[model samples]
Structures are given as C-alpha cells and as structure tokens.
Target: MTEERGDVQELSDFELAVYEAVAEIDKAGGAADIGTLTAQIDRPEEEIWAALSHLVSANHLHSTADGYTLGPHDWAP
Candidate 1:
C-alpha cells in the first residue's frame, strides 16, 4: 500500500504537521492518541481532530484501539 510521492506532496501544511507528530510518537514509542498529539503539537484539539480525520481518510494514518499509527501507505520516503 505504498503511497505515491505525489500523494505525499499533496498534503496541506497542517496535515503534514499532524503526520510528523505521529511519526514522532512512533519514535518515542508512544501511542498517537489525541492527548499525546495535542501535547506534542501546538494545535487546538479541533484542528488536530480535523487533521487526523483527513489523514485517516487519505490513508496516511490508521486508527486502532491503541491509537493512530502510520498506514501501510505512509512509509517515509
């Protein structure tokens, strides 16, 4: 499910920020939950939620009972 480079390029600034924040969570061995993301990134909960929703919709992130994580298509270039 690798995503095209064009798909990565199409992300908005906020979406990229959310994606980066999730990556950081992975690096830190933490869950990409709303609370953790809100703390790690300086955005409002509503904004984070919006970005998360968009990321999920775009198949850039996946949600699980543990939390959100990079989707199969979201491997770094």
Candidate 2:
C-alpha cells in the first residue's frame, strides 16, 4: 500500500525512524527483523513494534515473512 505523495508528510517521527531503520538494514544487506530493530532503536520493544506497524500501514515500510523493508515510494525528506 503505497501512500500518495501528499500523504508522505503524514508519517510520524517514530514511524519515519522505523522506516529509516529498515532502509539502513536493507542497505547493509540485512533484513529489519524485530531483534535488529530492537537493537538499533533505544525505545522499548513494544514501542518499536508499534512504530513498525504504523510505518507498514503508512506505506513507508514493507513487511514480509523475513522482516520489514523499505516500501514502494518515491518520496524523500
């Protein structure tokens, strides 16, 4: 679910951070799983899960059986 261009700004800071975490992991040739996200983000695991869910819903991140990755969108900050 790719969000529209105008909706890109609707992403919250934590959601964006989650998305960036996935991006970084993908860049490093790794999948952004719960453990990786938990290690990279200082927040509690529950908060990280919430942010990841929001990011996936907002189309900023993609979730697969492996883990999360950057979603299909062209928008950049």
Highest-lDDT candidate: 1
TM-score of each: 0.79, 0.79
- Residue ranges of candidate 1 with Cα displaced over 4 Å: 1-6, 74-77
CA-lDDT, candidates in order: 0.81, 0.78
lDDT of 1 by residue, 1-77 (tens): 44533377778998999998897786676659998888888878999999888888888888888889877643453
Candidate 2 Cα misplacement greater than 4 A, ranges: 1-6, 75-77
Error (Å) of candidate 1 at residue 15 is: 0.7
What is the Cα-based lDDT of residue 22 in candidate 2? Answer: 89
Model 2: weakest 10-residue lDDT segment is: 1-10
Q: Give residue 72's error in model 1 in angstroms.
A: 1.6
